[model samples]
Target: MGGGQQYPTTCFNTVIKTVVLAGLLAQKPFKHIAGFTNSLLKCYAPDLHTFYSETMDHIHRWNPNLRCNFSATVSVFAAATFNFRPQTITFPHLDFANLAWGWCAITALGDFDPNKGGHLILWDLKLIICFPPGSMILIPSALICHSNTSIGSHEKRFSFTQYTPAGIFQFVDNRFKSEKEVNSTEMSAEERAARVEARKIRWAEGLKMYRKCPSALP
Candidate 1:
């Protein structure tokens, strides 16, 4: 993904999110990207092949439709396991599902550097993730937000971030609505007072780390 893509608004906590992102980002290259597991003599039965097989199996279980989007089909494999708030309102185009462990092939393993290419960011209280490939992490479905930085055009980045049963909601639109409403109208005296109360509520609601987007990135 690039700069234009964004993730959903989350109600999930930060520490748990940090743990998940760090786990995936810290995976050993070979285990993170299956192709590295193939020794010279074992080239025929490469990790890529095994990973694909496993991914297909997991997809079948997670999505009964067996549907694969154009973008999703092109990237290497990866899987995220989490539970979502079924009762909360969701974006219209986003998908959610449970995934089996060891799914998806390595898309871009050991190929990224912090400075060279755009990085993966799991944004919540702030930008909390930078995935390096092959390591697996679990995040809360309802709270984690993720997106990648822009990469060079000539360079190849085969990573894919997917949510099964996708297209059920559109997350960006919701964020836009909230952001616009908060920015557009001028606040009346009473409204301004109420806004302060709202802010206080957010602070009391364990959103102490609630943050504004970075000027350089957003």
Candidate 2:
């Protein structure tokens, strides 16, 4: 998040955005994993899905060799994670880093009885859903506080999650420039007011892009 335009950005682990144009990139075998997730997004939230897909395309156009094209379609998410390393129940929290109106995909895995434990808790909805193994669900995690129940000590539970951070969108919307670059520039009062107004409109503009689920995945 601290990187400047035309520079590589990373979080040491789970995220690495580079603009290096040199070297041959090896084929990512997990393209199918990403592909499947993208399909889920398309099925439930077509408009939001398109937004992410187009954003990736825009990224490629912004930097012809930014090293972000891990898959042909760029899939959907900027990042994916596995929660299987050590089974633990996630505490209720909002994924404030993700785009507030966009979705985060979640899939349950491992051996755990849904009736006994490992239910998804949507705090705002006041619902504790039995998340079946291998079932996938999408939610606006940035807007919702959610978590899950702890599994039995003898049982195992894992989760897969996909999301793109709001910073990535901010970076793109700022024309690939970092916030510091924009803020440090000298501007007239009118220009400053315009920028503030633009910021104010972003949330409302984004809300317009949200869509209801078309139908259940067949």
Candidate 2 structure, TM-score to reference: 0.81
What is every candidate's alpha-carbon RMSD to the true fold? Answer: 18.4, 4.9
Cα error, residue 63 of model 1, in Å, equals 14
Writing each residue's lDDT as its tens digit, candidate 2 over 1-218 gives 32333332533432232222112123343455567778877876787888887877776677676445246464767666667645658999999878999888888878888899989999999999999777778889999999999888888887778788887787777777777777888989999999999989988978876665658445
Q: Stretches of candidate 1 above 4 Å error?
A: 1-110, 133-135, 160-218
> How much lDDT does each candidate structure score?
0.36, 0.73
> Candidate 1's C-alpha lDDT?
0.36
Q: How many backbone clashes does candidate 1 have?
A: 16
TM, every model = 0.28, 0.81
Estimate, for each residue in 1-218, the C-alpha lDDT of model 1 and write its tens digit.
11132332222349988677556535554232333322210233234234444444544454456333222323233333232222111221212232222122213333445465546455664653454534333232334454456545544344433332121111221332333455576869898798678656642442322222343133
Best by lDDT: 2
